[model samples]
Target chain A: MESFVDVFLFGKCYSVPDNLTIMGAMEYAGYQLVRGCGCRNGFCGACATIYRIRGDRELKVCLACQTKVENNMYVATLPFFPLIKEGFELEKVSPDVSVMMQLYPEIYACVGCNACTKSCTQGLNVMQYIAYAQRGDFAKCAEESFDCVMCGVCSSRTSGCRRSGTESSRICSPRSCRSPWRN
Target chain B: MYTGEILESMKKVEAARDANLALEPRRMTAEEKDALLSAYHPDYKESEFETLKIGVSRGDKVPHELAALLQGKPRIGAGDADLTKIDYDTDVLIIGGGGAGSSAAIEADNNGARCMIVTKLRIGDANTMMAEGGIQAADKPNDSPAVHYLDAFGGGHFAAKPELLYKLVNEAPDAIQWLNRLGVEFDKAPDGTMITTHGGGTSRKRMHAARDYTGAEIMRTLRDEVLNRGIPVIDYTAAVELILDENGRCAGAVLMNMETRELRVARAKTVILATGGAGRLHYQGFPTSNHYGATADGLILGYRAGAKLLYADTLQYHPTGAAYPDQIYGALVTEKVRSLGAKLVNAKGEVFMHPLETRDVSAASIIRECGDRGNGVKTPDGVGVWLDTPMIERIGGEGTILSRIPAMHRMFAKYGIDIRVEPILVYPTLHYQNGGLDITPDGMTAVENLYAAGEVVGGIHGRNRLMGNSLLDVIVFGRNAGRCASEKAKSVEPGALTLSHIDAFLKERGDAGIEGDTVSPKLLPVYTHGNPDVPKKPF
Candidate 1:
C-alpha cells in the first residue's frame, strides 16, 4: 500500500500519496484546476502557494509544483491578483519615470515587509527590484527580473509587484518599445 | 497595414519571381535526384556510418533479431485485479498536449465526454510551439482540396495513403474554420482573404498563417480554450504503457510522473495518442528540431498494446535547418523564407538545386553537393550551403522580413546575425517521423479502443511530408480521432482488464525466437557534437 500523509487542503483534512508535491496532493484531493497552475515545471511561477501548521506560526511559501505537502499543513493557492495597467501607444511613449508611474502607479505601494522577495519562486529579489522601480531605475529592475515568466506569483505575494504580463516584460524585454535601453 | 495598392505592386514582384524561378534556381530532375541518392548510398541501413543505428530504409520485413527493440514493455496485470487503486478515470484520455492533443481534447469535450489530457511537458510547451511556418489549408477559391491533395501526393512520391491524404486535403478548410472559431488568428491580406503562400511542393498559395508563429498562435489558443473549458490535465506525466482489456482491446494507460518518478494508472474508455515525432532519435546522424519529449513514447505505448506500426523506417529531414552558429543549432528555418524567393548558394557562389524542391530531394541534393562533391563551404560548425536571407528583404521590401518572419528574424537577431543583411548557413535536420502507429482514416488504431492523431500516427504522408501539411495533418486527424473516440466512448461500458494479451505478445515473440536489440527507443544512440560516437557525415 502506498503511504498517505494527512494535510489540510483549503481547510479540509485529506490523506494523499506520500512524498507528492503540493500540486500533486491537491489533485489527489480532488481539486480540479482552472488556474494557479502554469508550467507544472518550476519554469512558470503561477502555482505559488502559502502554507502553515495548525499550532505553529511559521508562514511558509513555495511553488505548489515543486514543494512537497507536509503532514498537518494548511495551505491555500494564491489567485491571480488584480493589478493596474495603463495602456498607451508604445512608439509614442517616452518610457521614463513619469511614464512608469502613469502606467503602474501601484509600484509605489511597497511596504518594507519583504514578503514578495521572501516568497519569490525564481529567487528574484522582488523588494530590491521594487525599490529600483520606485527609484525610477527601470534598467536595474529589468535586469533583476529578466527571467520572469509572468506566472503572477510575485504580485499575489506583494502589494508592489502588481501588474504581470506587460509589466514583467515591459520593464525588461529588449524587444518591447518601453525597454529601459536597447541591447 | 497592407493596402490594395501595395498588394498590386507586390504582385508584380511575385509575378517576376515566378517567371525566373525555373531558370534562376535549376530544378533537379528525378533522374538527377536518384543519381545523388545513389552516390550517397541513400539507405539508412548503417553499413556506411559505422555501427551507429542511424540511417533511412525503404522497408523490409525485419528479421526477428532486430524486431525486439520496437516491442512494448511487458503489460501489468489487469485494470482492477490488483485491487489497488485507479488514479484517474475518464471517458476519453488524450496522451499528448500538442496542437493535435489540445484540438482533440476540445472536440471530445464538445461531444460531451469527460476528457483528460496527460502530457510529458507543460500543456503549451510542444514542438507545435516551436513551429513557425504557416498551416496549409484550401481556403482560397483559386486553390482547392484537389490541388492540395495532388501536391501532397506528389511530395510523398505517391507513397502516402490515399484515404488519409484525401481526408487531409478535404477536411482542411473545415479544420481552419474550427481553428478560427477557437480564436486562432490567421494572417489576412487587405481584402481580408487569408494570406496564402506556397511551400516546397504546393501548386498554389494555400498556406494560412499568423505572422510567422502560426503554430504558436493555434497551439496557445487551443490551450487557452482547454483551460477555459476546465478540462483536467495531468501535466508533466508521460504515458509509458497502454493498458489492455481481456479481449486485447486498449482499456487505458499507465502514466509515469516525469519529475516525481511515481507510477499512476488511468482507466479510460478510449486513449488518444497525440504525442508528436521522434526527430530526437537523431536518425541518420542529424540533429532534430523536435521538442525534448518527442522520443516515440506513444509509439512504444501503442505498439505494446497490440497496435500495428506503419512505415517504421522512414523519417523526414527538413532541408534548411540552422547548421551554423552553435547556439541555434537544429532550429528549423521556415520554408516561408524560400517561398519569399531566397536562393541556396554554395561556397563557390554557385547556385545549387532548385530552392522549391520537395524536402527529400532537396535535402539529398545538398548532402551530395557538400559531402560528396566537396562544394559546400567549410565552416567552424560544419560544411553547408548558405540560405540568402537578404534576398527575401530585397524582394519583399523593408518591413517584410520583420512582419512575415518575425520569430526567425528575432531569433537570429539575438545571435548577432541580422538576417536582413546577412545569410544564414543551413543543412538538413531531422524534422518529422513519416512512420508511426498505423491507424485508419478515422484515427482508430488496430486495437479496438486505441486511437491516434498528430505526428504520432504514420502513413498519412508516406515517405515525405510537405512543409505546411504537418499543421493541417494534426488538426484534421485530431478532430477526427477526438469526435470518433467520444462517440464510441458514449456507447461502450467500462471494459474488463486482460493480462492474457501480455502473455500472448511475449509468447509470440518467444516462440519466434526473436533476437537482436531489446532496448527502448530512448536507448537509441543520439549524436551531439560532443559525443565521441557521433557518426561522421557519410558520403
Candidate 2:
C-alpha cells in the first residue's frame, strides 16, 4: 500500500508520496523555492529549514536535501541571509582559489538586499561583493569578501528569498554549479 | 701539428719536464683518446656551454687548444634504471604517518639526518583526523601533574608504564603549547586563556578543543608544519615488512607503492613503527570507528621484525555512538556531549549511570543494562540505549546545537527522532585501542633501532583513555620518539647491504604476498592464529 504524505508549506497544505523527499514534494506542489548551489550530501547545510509535524508539538531542524517528506509535516524555509551572523564559522572556509571562483557568480546575484549584509555579525559587505562578483571583477570581490567569515549567513537568508519566487510556491529543482576538482 | 696520441704524448713530455712539481701525466692510446673524447663531451652537439670562447691567463687559464676538451657534457645515468629503487642510506626510516611517524620525521629531520616517512594513506588521514575530543593536560591552576598522573594511573587500572605516563602528563602542556605555535586554533576564553572542558575520568576541566573537531584541527596543523619543513611523505605507501639485518638490530623496511605495483627497499640504520591501532577486526554491533586501512599493519610488521607486542587485548569502547540503521551508526559522539551535560537514559527515560563515573564503568553499565533490558528498555539494535536530549538543549542552546553539532541533528533525523524534542538512541562502539607495540618512555621499541608512538603504542592508556588525552599522546610522544630516532640516526651510518642482500630482502617480502596487494589472503594467518578464545571487541 502506498502512503500519502501531506506537507504544509507556509500556510498551504499539499499531499505527496511517502517516498518523495520534502524538497521533491515541494516542487511537485508547483511552488518555486530558491535553491542554492546544492551539495546534496548535506554537509553544506545549504537547504536547512525549521520543520514541525502537525500534532507533534516539538520544533525540529533539518537540511531539506536529506530529509524525506513525513505525513502532515510543517516546514518553514528560512532565507540563507539571516542565519549567517548566528551560524557562520570562519575556519571552515576553503582557501582554495578555484573554489572562490565558483562561488563568485552567485555572489553577484545579491540585489542590494541588505538582508544578508546587515545580518552579518562579522560586519561584512555581503551585498557589495555579490554585485562585484556579478560584474566579473574578482579583485573587488576579493576585497569585499574579506569580511565574510563564511558562516553561510548570506546563503541561508537568500535561500528562500521572496523576490526569487512566491512563498506559497514550492521550488524543488536542484541548481547546477561547477564541480571543484580534488587535487 | 700534433696527432691525438702525439698531444697525449706531449702531456707525458710535460710531466717529465715537471717531475719535481708532483705532476703525473699519461699518454692516451688511439682507442683511449677516442673514448675520452666521446665520454667527456657526449652532448657536444647539444651543449650550450660550447658557445663560450676559451682564453688563457698566467695564473689560471684554459688553453684554447683544449677548448673542445672543456666543453660541457649531458650527464646520463649508467643505464635505464629506476631512480625510486636507488637505495637511500639513511639513519632512520619511520613507518606509519599518523602522530607518531610525523613527529619522528620532524625530530629526525631537525637532528640533521636523512629521514623518510611511508604512510598507508595521506600523512594526516590516520585516527588522529577522526579525534573529536580536545587534548588533556594539567594546565589548570588547581591541577598538578601528580594529580593528573594519579588520575591516569587509576583510569588505566595501573597497567600503564609509570615512566611513560609520568612523561606524558608532565610534558603534555608543553606539547599543547607546541601545537599552538604550529597554528592550531584552540578554543579560547575571554581572558585569552585556553578554554578547558570536562571529559570521562578527569577531576579537572583540562580538555581543550576547537569546537568538536579538535583532532582534525591538531592533525591539520601538524600536517602543515610537516609539509612546510620539507619532510618527504610517501603517501599511499604501505609498509609490508620490517627489514631485519643478520645482527638482528632493526634496520629498514620493504615498501609497496600502492599506486604502482612496485617493490622498493628502504635501507636505514633505524626504523620506527608508528602504525595506529587495530579497530576494524571486531564483531558487528560494536562500532569500529577506525579507517579501513587500520588493520594492525604496524603491529604485525613490528612483531615479525622481532619486536615484542604488549597488551593487544585491552580495547576502549566509547559509550555513545549513533544506533543502528544509520551509516555512521558506530561513529563517535564526542564526549564533549557529556561535558556539556547530556545524560544517558534507559528506554523509560531515567538516567542510568552515575553521569560522573569513568567512561569504562559507564560503558560497562550501559552494556549491562542493554543485556538485561531492565528499566523498560530493550536494546534498539542489540546494543542501543537512549540519551536524554532535554538536558543537551538546556546546556547548549538549540542554535548552538544545530550549528556546532550538525551531525548529531542528522543522526536523529535519520531515525525519525528530533534530538531537540526527544531522547536519542545511542550505544557503545569501538573508539580507541589501549595497547599496541611496546616502547620505552622515549618511544623506542625492544628492537634496538625501532620506536612506536600514537595509538600503535600501548601503556599510555592502561585500560581506558581519557577523552582529550589521545590527541595529547600523539603530539607529546610523537615528538619524543622523533627526537630520539634523530639522535640515533645522526651517529649511525647506513650499513653495507649488497645487491644479493637486497635480493634476499625482496624475496622475504615476496613470501608475505604480492607487492602492493592490500587484500592478500596471506594475512589470514596473522589474524586467525592470535588470541582465539578471547572475544574480540569492536574498536
Best by TM-score: 1
Candidate 1 C-alpha lDDT tens digits along B110-208: 899999999866686567766778889887878889988999988887888899999999999999988776556677666767888888888898878
Residue B226 displacement (Å), model 1: 0.7
Query: What class would a CAPRI assessor give candidate 1's docking?
Result: incorrect
Every model: Cα RMSD to truth: 13.8, 28.4
Q: Is the docking of candidate 2 incorrect, acceptable, medium or high quality?
A: incorrect
User: Per-residue lDDT for B1-539 in model 2, tens only?
Assistant: 22343234333333332231222223234354334323422112133222212111112122121122222110111122232364555677878787667877877787887788887656765777667767899988999888888888877767888898999999988988877765566777667699887777788888888766667556655655566567788876766666655666677776666556466678887788887765554422255666445556676566545455555555677777666434345667777777776666665444555554556665666766666555423332344666655456656666655544544565555656566655555677767777777788878888777888888888887856777778888888888888888787666654543223234433544563324313321111111112234333211
Q: lDDT score, residue B503, model 2?
A: 42
TM-score of chain A of each: 0.77, 0.44
